[model samples]
Target: MEQKVFAFLMFSGQADEAMKLYVSAFEDAGIVSAKYYPQSEPGAKPKVLHAIFSIKGQQVMCIDNQLSDSHPHAFTPALSLFVNCDSEAEINEVFAKLAEDGKVLMPLSPSPVSTLFGWLEDKYGVSWQLNLPAR
Candidate 1:
């Protein structure tokens, strides 16, 4: 059976911001659905409990983990979102938007396998690899 696999991003109270940034940065992207946590206490800030968003037709699930600080849920570069960009300009644009306020592991450069490739960790700690595939 063919299965639809979705990348799930677990954020430490940055799910909403990340979702907004992703939806705005990528073409043909938008939030599919989201559920928020109600303000349980006085002056408590509301947060995204769960959400689903698509970036360039790829569906991603995410949530804000309240117990993230104590849990070993830090995002690592081992499992990054590998983006196969359609063009050099597209890869550059996407990299620029996602790399803002983030750390660049590998700057955009041509490789033997790709004309342009780069890896970065976004502000919310999610890792991404942008690549321009051969036509």
Candidate 2:
């Protein structure tokens, strides 16, 4: 058996949409595999049961949580996916894309730790931290 750990995001009903957006936002990112919920019940909306995707060589899993309403907890900035960008331009571009229809926690600007850094929550409420390491 393969024992591995990865970030698993639970979405209400937007797992597939979020996966597509992520694949488009980052280079070398794509969905590896996805399984959909069986349409056993009438009027049941198809949703992602499980999915594995890669972003910049990092694997992340996502699912459409059936119990999302029961679990009121949500993704928070306290635990954000941090991306270390190679260039200021890359960081800026990524920040712009992520900020679309989203709330910016921190504007992309020069910081003491990095030449450029920003924090934002995507439309799906997933928090991200984009940073360009200080030279």
Candidate 3:
């Protein structure tokens, strides 16, 4: 089946940093495309305007808040990105990288429903769930 929906992430001004961290944490991830604001642009910070990144081939869209943006909305733990890891080593590696300067809601350890599971909110305020499916 073809993918029709994609996860979209919004950051106040950390879109680029978050994208970099995510891409670096996952082995099969990379920034597909990114548009950034020029310093000359009025009232616009020199930051990511829009970006499309892929994690394990799943396309995710993200953007930094615009100049006219007024909402004080910030990323909440209510929503999180769930990653299914291929192995124990993969989960540990990915989790360790993501956990840097981040909050760990759930320690990486054996869980009731999975062999290994962890939940965290990254330094940029994005939440993520890393899991190794039961074998």
TM-score of each: 0.90, 0.87, 0.90
Model 1 — TM-score against the truth?
A: 0.90
> For candidate 1, lDDT tens digit of each residue in 39-79?
78887655789999987777899998978778858899999
Clash-forming residue pairs, model 2: none
**Whole-model Cα lDDT per candidate?**
0.88, 0.87, 0.89
- The parts of candidate 1 lying over 4 Å away from their true place are 1-3, 41-45
Clash-forming residue pairs, model 1:
none
> lDDT for model 2, on a 0 to 1 scale?
0.87
Per-residue lDDT over 74-104 for candidate 2, one digit per residue giving the tens place of the 0 to 100 score = 7787888888988877777778888899999
- 15-123, model 3: which lDDT tens digit per residue? 8888998999998999999999776767754588889999988999998876527775688999999999998999999999998998999999997789999999999
Model 2 scores worst on lDDT over the 10 consecutive residues at: 1-10
The list of candidate 2 runs beyond 4 A from truth reads: 1-3, 39-46
| Clash pairs (backbone) in predicted model 3 | none
Candidate 1 worst ten-residue window by lDDT? 1-10
Q: lDDT of model 1 at residue 67?
A: 88
Candidate that beats the other on lDDT, 1 or 2, i.e. the better one? 1
